[model samples]
Target chain A: MTAAPTRLACFGGIYSNYLALEAALADVRRRGVDAVYCLGDLGAFGPHPDRVFPLLADHDVVCVQGNYDDSVGNELDDCQCGYVDPQDNHFAQISYDYTLAHTSAEHRAYLRQLPAEIRLEIDSRRVLLCHGSPRRTNEFVWESTASDHFLERLCREADADVVLATHTGIKWQRQLAEGRQFVNVGVLGRPENDGRRNVWYTLVEFGGDQVQVEFVPVEYDFARLAREMADEGLPAEFQETIRTGWWTTCLEILPVKERRRGAF
Target chain B: MAATLPVIDDPRVPQVELASFDQLWFQVAGTLCNLTCHHCFISCSPKNDSFGFLSLDEVQQRLAESVPLGVNEYYFTGGEPFLNPQMVEILIATLEYGPATVLTNATVLKDEWLQRLADADAASRFSLEFRVSIDGFSPETNDPIRGEGTFARALRGIVKLVEYDFLPIITAARSWPEADEARVVGEFTEMLRREGYRRPRLKILPMLHLGAEVERTHGYRPSERITAEMMKGFDRSQLICDHARIVTDRGVCVCPILIEAPDAVLGQSLAEADRPFGLSHGACYTCYQYGAICSNPSAASGGGHAARPT
Candidate 1:
């Protein structure tokens, strides 16, 4: 019997941007994708979670806890992701508080019970859904890790053909030796660092034997969101990132050695 | 085929000094800090003394050996260096070598201590600089992270330094949007000017995720880090401290930041530490891409660019 190819959406870090999420959903609907999976960190950092949550629910997106989502869901005081300098002034703090308040309790509850990992099948091909690293939700797994053994072990344990991840927002896909692939669907609220204003999302088409993931940059008018955040007196910093497609509050996100190393 | 052209790892690879100055930060009080700021790179706090104090004798012993090898200045850092009872003596001995800088939260620079340090700075032949870390200008802004009343106490410390004609360089983390940075720094500069210092050196630092910082936010995303192959065109010379060493109470170590990392210890003496490091961590990129992270001129300093001395 000829196999029916399955297509899926692998994406996360919505950061509460309704415009971007709506655009992404439209794409998913058009593609007639098979499954919708999130990398984690649904909100917290951006200004518009109220709108993004409904979309996730309507789409019945499979999601996980990003560090920000974890802190908010846990009712924790800080964003457990270790991304900010506690000593920051009200400008930054105001932003964090705003993001925290914008997060829906239902979404927080959803995130609270969310699985750190998930496994999927595409016509018999295996796939793993992990936020950052397997088992460790807040860990940062990048190309720099360059460790084959760990990924190899993960694929074996999950009995999967590919791993999908998010948190460090960027589009990347690499093939390990046999048939394993590591892909990060990227974040929707922040710019992709490629100097583009549009955020990133990914759609994967899978056949019985092969899977193809494509980076889709979605453009939207952030004027309403930016103005709304400003009106809400949310962190001006948060408002700025929504408009600029980048973040400036680089506290915990900046590695100490790298901080000292100076970035342009 | 007779002339075997050398591979890219050729002798022609240029070398640049990463940092002649070493941030041999003496976590004098260990992980014990005066304030429990959320994004502390190493996550130090008042009660968390995971690392312990190195007495005057220990510091002096390390310094004695360091000067002979052309080791430059010494820097004293801690949960609060002054928290140490013998911190004065540590400073006294440190100044005799090159110059000394003590990084303080400025939450507790008592009058008696400041008077002594100012006297020593004037007496010393080498340059002595005091760098203070403050997150923002106002209490509403700075206090949230540093605890209430810290900004008030910190300001008094800065005022005292200015009174003594000691232009202390104020450092603040870049915790706001880039568009607001200039205004924020300008306000700091203006505040410092009104407080009696003419030229205020402010440093805008990138946050390092460590210790409590990890709990506050996430650490480096797996995306950030250096690889073996990426080091090909990388200037080996820029990782300066790799060739040098830090003589601590324990022994000589690779670099300041790596003190906590395993295999951080290179050898017993400064000369013995002559070797190259793999630049395995995310922080290595800071050194490789930018020149130095520890030894910037001001707190409001700009982000790094490909700068060569004019």
Candidate 2:
């Protein structure tokens, strides 16, 4: 058992957005967090998949494997994005094929070696970090869908006082029974479909028995990323999300409340 | 033409125990619907009072009881959930506990009801999902099965839902051949886009060969029964009975699809309903083929789809 730090920076689903990752890493360093972590999904929906690896390695960001990482690392055919709609699947397939083709073999090997989950003690408060939920690597714990009691059960099953996950690309936190907490750290890959041209990361600070969770928004060179995506021959829909904050693809999986908040 | 229930007492039938109470379904409007669709699995009709409406009080009671069990989501169904006058209130109340999804025919929806639901959903942290059933893409194709003028009426209801900012999932049972799936889905998307739904969500469902559907098509064959051998290495979570239970006016049922069967009623409460169910019914075969058919797309898993999301 290693000693846990009081403050940490965490993010997930980079989606190969190296510009955002660079900005986020610099921001994390400026905040003076004791350590940094990433919740897998290091590639997809962006250009230059190889650009993200050195940023993570230089920062010593410990990572947990996401479903996308699992798929790309193993050379799987699709992204395993769990979309049911035909149009959504069509776009996802395009992104997955591009990401898989562009990802370097060395980076693929690194993704394959990443652990599915990481456990640590933050001031004696057990914190479990995983790409999605602790139970399933690809589960979407959307803020509008996950219940307090359900989160409590997940904590109990994982034997953690705090659970941090990403994968839904949205950030939310809920304090559960016995002061336990579950946090979905927003992604750094793209905007959260909120019509804002910025991505987000999460900061967790431990004080005695209290765990504080904060979502930190990061602004980067979006126009450049959009240009890169277009140059890579990615779908216009993917670049549209980077240029504009609204998500153009993968709209069906969103719950109604979350979908209502978006501009479509 | 009523559908006949099959009785199978073979011990070889696979028994699936409750994995977790993730989804709690309410047969809120009971077996009474505004339209008598030809392929309705439960044969719901305007006068089919075989199952009775569940009041807001009953739903509230179940919601309270379901909290401690760690239920993840809630669903409301019936002949048509909106037919129950308190359907909006029930959905609002459910949002307080967990995410709620309602399955409806869309013809009975009113603007006022959607307004209230939209307001409630905005305030709550949980989502309120609507699954609107429209049999086909156009009136010529859909009216004969659902009812005359039902296609146009349902489209109006869907447009209203969109106006209220509800991304209602258009659910349709696959009446056309499988080879035409792409064409049918494409047409449905085009029609919805023309009707002001810029980002239409569609779910194609397999026909459950029971109830009114038995009269239209045929019931499941005897070989469709799931044997104990079939359960080997299978992901049991794909089965609704493995993770869900439905509360009706009478009591808790095993699953939403088998409510008319006498053996489907498990108990009076969620606690008592936490038991294993035999996969012996013919409709169970449809569930076996098409996993999580009654659940919203958000919770469904496995069945000729891409892998789970990243």
Candidate 3:
């Protein structure tokens, strides 16, 4: 196994948000990070799906295959976001259709070839990176719902000292037994429904005894993106979420505590 | 639907091995309920004591046992979870362990209990969810199935839950036809909003053909049984028996739906209960048809509607 970089920048689910991706990449470059990684979901819920590919390629962002990536790459019927509600699914379908139609064939091929998971040894600490939980590609590992022991078991089963994932869109970190850690590296595609118009990424640094995890918020041209979405005929709900940082669609999949924290 | 079946080993019966102890359920109220709904799958009523209430000490014991086993979330159900005297305490204690969800009819909820529960949930890192049962959008449609005035009472309880900043998920059995789903859900959402619930969460359940429901409507036919052929390429994780085990006063049962069956009681402890369950019950068919029927829609155990790749 190759030794991973000591300082790494990680983001999850670009969701076709090239503007945010640009800003996040610039911020990480300024921070002098050794490596930058993206945990899949390269497309969905945003306009101009093709715009994100060049930025990722230029920045040398390593990728993992998200459920959306799996669907769009394979030309599947729906984005397997794991939403059971009809309204949520309806909006998800709209996003998926728009994304799949707009994504370039070459980009789709790239997504298809992306690994489902990326493993590296960071300072001899086994680190695993995936779009969702290591067990399932589409699983929603929400903070309030995922118990400590459950996460510990997942870490033990995956044989990783640190597991980084971000399918649920929200960012949370939990310390497990024996100093193991599980972190959801938030999402760059949209705001985290915290009534703030800034999306976030995570910086994981391992050199000392403790593993340092920092959530770095990226302020970008969200108004321009929303206007672009309107021009592209994306749902007003999606734009509203981008502008207000409050999720308007796909609300049912959120666990009770998470939903209660949101304006919707 | 055929009167309860005996636990006989059949070669055709497909057995589902426990995948992970993700969900730990407690039959907190047992079969005793304040109101007797016509379509109750377990036939719970005021006089029905086939099952008994689980005390706080019993629930705490199981919660402790669940930690090492890596139980993801906890669910509390029965005729009505609030019917149990220690329901509030049980939930508060459970919050220390993990996220807790309780299924209730909402007619017997007290403000004091809601206040205390809300405070406990606020302090804990886990979520405390309430799934209120209301059969219809209006009393005219709902009263016939659930007792009279229950629709109004349930609405009031929902409003109280909202006042406590709790987004209660209104779970209604699909008493109406599939065609009317959109209309019924819309009306239900509107009704709750008018009653002071701004953002209403709703979960519609397919009526299980068992217990009181079997008498009200019809039982499962022989054709409804799941065959070994049906298990081919099927996602067994969708079935509750593959991930969940319920702790009843009698013992740890296979799943919540089949507690009435003597064979449902698998063992006394979580360790002993961790075994493959035979999907022989007719209700298992409903579970097979619609996975995660008993779990909250947002729960990890709840099956997604999207078509997963085989």
Candidate 4:
């Protein structure tokens, strides 16, 4: 007997927006996506890591460790984002120094237990699920990075039908050399480079000769999250950035111009 | 009638930046976030300890190792960079060798921290910039994803930056459509102006799929891999990680993003990462696509765009 071709919804970076998560599941049902590949960072920068992680863990998601996940899983003192700064405010420094006093040993153990990368065969193609790059769980891949760098990484470090990544919180999709593909599922927990407070996610469908990656958006209540952060005693600035998408911290690596571009 | 197949694939389409910073990034902060949002890329709650922090000594060692090679920049990111215990010390250390930037959710802005950052920036020959992430204009617009009271708090924080005489660029993710960009910015400006912030600058970023975002939406496609043919005649220079290397406590990683990859570890030095590398991930494709078509075409970004702005 023959089997039906598989359909996949390759998403990543669900930073804890339950409303958006609900919408994504609805999308999967509507699209009849057979499988869902969660690239990693199952929790970070949002209010309900516990709520979200349990839900995702229950699903048949192909999960990997995101840079943030590494921090959470390990109970590392810092996020290890490597954000270069001239002065190093206490917030980031504190984040780096923080320990897992509140979380259970089980959750910390599980995060460490998560794989850096996951590989699956889809449409006769080897799909690699990684938080950053395949070899590194915390690497951040962005559009500004070079091609030969990527080509060399793909050709030399590892090979796959497509490399799915998260972090940088952006939605992007591109085709690479040698019939390979790259998809940035974007951040469902956050906005996709716009000023409005909506979220983004992607849906991918594979056909006999064609493949497609779709970016999906959702709406949720932000006040609840802010209140949660407040209730949790999170930093006021960090809580506020969630609402505004603006960083209170100084990014030493950003272009001088990327500094202070948005007023609100 | 002229036939326009909609250019299913735009031959002359402007490209998108998809390459990973491929460098190994540090988990400067684990799940311990300054703020908790609904749609955090990695649902980082106050208690979520996922990644660990590198010691100042480790960072110093990494810096020394990275200087020999062309690797020149460093970035700090996390639940809250300021939240890290040794953040100030870490920045002081990183400035010795390379310029640095810190990516933060920007809800809390302390006058002392900004003053210190400014002083250090003034003191250092290397550059320092801040990329603040504020999702929307009003509480109604932004609070849904970030959390309750976030809009007011974040705006107040931004206002505080203005008090520090800073016009911090507001980083907003593009949750809205292509059409709403200007109004968004305009509204943002009006709000900031009312808050005493003038000369508003904005950077709208697309969302990334990972962590909490995965639950927020469906993921990618089977066909989204980067093919060998995708690189034909493409300018690989736009991908900065090719020429750049990141120094971490563990060693000199290829780029700041992929610290876990052994190959990315690149010996104990940046000089080692200088060796040629193959574009290995799907993020590379994004680098090519947008690096081809997407530019900060916005008038606010009057200057030519940086390969990666943040």
Choose the strongest candidate by DockQ: 3
Q: How many steric clashes between backbone atoms does each model show?
A: 32, 1, 1, 219
Per-candidate DockQ versus the true complex? Answer: 0.01, 0.49, 0.55, 0.03
Candidate 2, residues B170-214, lDDT tens digits: the string is: 999988889989998888889889999988888888888889888
Better of 2 and 4 by TM-score: 2
Give per-residue lDDT, candidate 2, residue A191: 98
Pairing residues by index, what is the TM-score of model 3?
A: 0.98
Q: Give one digit per residue, the lDDT tens place, for model 4 in B1-310.
A: 0010011232332332323333334446544687876556546678766445667877776656543322334667666776877777787776665556666666765777788877776666555545577777778878887888988887777777667654566777666776887787678778777878655556666554334544566333334444557756554544545445555445555543333333445656444545544445333444444441112211111111111111
Kindly list the interface RMSD, in angstroms, of each predicted candidate in the order they appear.
18.0, 3.9, 3.2, 13.5
Better of 3 and 4 by DockQ: 3
Candidate 4, A39-134: lDDT as tens digits: 766665555466675666666666676655677676665655534232323555543333334445676777677767766676776666666555
In order of appearance, the predictions have TM-scores of 0.48, 0.95, 0.98, 0.46
**Model 1 segments more than 4 A misplaced:** A1-264, B1-25, B229-232, B235-240, B243-250, B296-310
Candidate 4: lDDT of A174?
63
Whichever of 2 and 3 has more TM-score, that candidate is 3
Q: Please write out the lDDT profile of model 3 over residues A68-103, one tens digit for every residue.
A: 998898888888888888999999999999999998
Docking class of 3: medium
Share of reference contacts kept by candidate 4 = 0.04
